[model samples]
Target: MTNVQLGAPNFRIVSTNVSGEASSRALFGVSYGLGMAATQFALIPLDDERTLYKAAISALWTRFETENGVAEGRKLALVNVRYDSESINTFFYTKVTTVVVADVVEFE
Candidate 1:
């Protein structure tokens, strides 16, 4: 029998949803690993929550890329994204801190 060797995967999984429900099912042979981040922001009551949430995710992705030295064209995939946040109320504004932990994968 000939020995078969497997190479790197051609694709990766990146999802913002839990349960992998909104992601493509196409199979990839390999994966990187998980990444976690804590992002904080101070906002007045009028600040947009949705926008900040999106920013937090973006920051997390940036952090992953910087730490991993991932190539520019390479894509970052996040799955099983678990998010938690805490709010500290102050006299002038609220400080919101978020922690995001996910199954992070890097692929071409």
Candidate 2:
């Protein structure tokens, strides 16, 4: 149980429960061995969807982390990006992009 300090009105602290269903999903993907990574696409509606964002995300990871500890034959592929729209405030909106990274047995 990790305690996270999220500053608030009363300066309340919250515990991070990774065992919850929400956090559990982050542990795996389509297949146990498949790799994935993701990031937010835009603040404005670039209208980026999962199918379109996959290629960009994959390229970004490879170019930046080609020398990672992964094996020679194992490369990171852009599995998909999760797009979410959140209404944090009445006058403004937030679009969250979650990039998923995974290790692959085969290279494309």
Candidate 3:
């Protein structure tokens, strides 16, 4: 694997995660703004569902660094952080598979 440096003060780092829920809700929100109020009701449930997925993704990142011997303070240039999630269960409200990746670039 190629090492990519991450962390430069000049540029802002942005991260995003895409899921079925987010996509559907985002579309609904956009449509609602365009005079499609009916979609908003369907999208509300998605908003709640996505929050749990987001939390899981965050925890996964925290655990990744801990398990991979990566120190949080280490200065590395990372760009284009992305994450994806999928539901694994419906009953009992416990199901999500999250995958995250980032471009690590050398800053110094």
Candidate 4:
């Protein structure tokens, strides 16, 4: 149970309940394996940060699909994704790259 103050005279209350079996194991806790890939953009004019991020993620997923067998229409899923970005500044422009690492999981 909780109370949220929206404004000076407005308020809202919320409540939530959860129940689960003790023997049930969490899905995210189980990691079949992990894969990592990097995408680089050098002297490329990108529309925005969102576009850059999307491109980086797409490249990582494509690598996984091609080499790691995480192809399309598969029951496997990627979770707990982590990534790092690096940029190199030069006299004329900057080169940016991102490395993504994620754990793979398969559904029963």
Candidate 5:
């Protein structure tokens, strides 16, 4: 049997989402693995609340060659935005800050 293992992407990615959905968008990308992000927001008079979100994601070195966005993280998700400061407040509120990028290998 052949032995093979994939190494994690060498990334110090510091992404700041703007107007994307509280729900993650799956776009094909070069990098693939599991991940999560911290989404936060505030109420008029109540304290801030946070939730955890996790999903399969990828980070591409470049955009996908094709238009089909089947693969996750094919491209960074985009949403409506006016100013950079309103990015966090426009989406779902959560504290999911870390996404564990990994692969699932099968033995044959």
Candidate 6:
């Protein structure tokens, strides 16, 4: 039960694939908890829908590091950093967001 930090060169991107099934990438290295969330608002019917959610998740991770100081400027390892997205339809196409939550851990 040891505490680990982020920013450590412990994680590495293994592979990335985009297809009809699912677009995702895999990372190899240590294990750690990396939680993320994304949100977006759309006005026009046809527009770039991926960028907004990506930005949101990025911001969420940044904030998590800044606030929790889990892996801030430290050699912490991470693996299998996955990304997923969903839509929230209410009144109108107002917003969309995505969240990625993972754990960074090292095996003994």
Best by TM-score: 4
Tens digits of per-residue lDDT for model 2, 1-108:
635333644331111111100111111122121123322322344343544235444544554345444333543232223332221222233232333333332233
lDDT by candidate, in order shown = 0.46, 0.31, 0.40, 0.43, 0.26, 0.41
Best by lDDT: 1
Any runs in candidate 4 off by more than 4 Å, and if so which? 1-50
lDDT of 1 by residue, 35-95 (tens): 3332333332343443444666667766666656653676555657776655454445444
List, residue by residue over 1-108, the lDDT tens digit for candidate 3. Answer: 765433545434332231122322332222222221112323223344444335544564565455444636755444565555543323223233345556443233
Task: Looking at model 5, report the run of 10 residues with the lowest lDDT sum.
Answer: 79-88
Q: Write the per-residue lDDT of candidate 6 for residues 1-108, one digit (tens) a residue.
A: 866555555554322221111111212211122244443434444434455445544555565565445555554344455566554445543333355544444332
- Runs in model 2 with CA error above 4 Å? 1-52, 59-65, 68-90, 106-108
User: Which stretches of candidate 3 lie above 4 Å from their native place?
Assistant: 1-73, 90-93
Using Cα atoms with residue i matched to residue i, what is each candidate's TM-score against the true structure? 0.46, 0.26, 0.32, 0.47, 0.19, 0.36
Candidates sorted by lDDT, best first: 1, 4, 6, 3, 2, 5
Better of 2 and 5 by TM-score: 2
lDDT of 4 at 83: 63
Give the C-alpha miss distance for residue 81 in model 6, angstroms: 2.5
TM-score of the candidate numbered 5?
0.19
Give the C-alpha lDDT of model 3: 0.40
lDDT of 4 by residue, 57-101 (tens): 566666665655645675554556666555454544544555556
Estimate the overall C-alpha local distance difference test score of candidate 6.
Answer: 0.41
Error at 99, model 3, angstroms: 1.9
Candidate 6 C-alpha error for residue 30, in Å: 39
The segments of candidate 6 whose C-alpha lies over 4 angstroms from its true place after superposition are 1-50, 70-72, 105-108
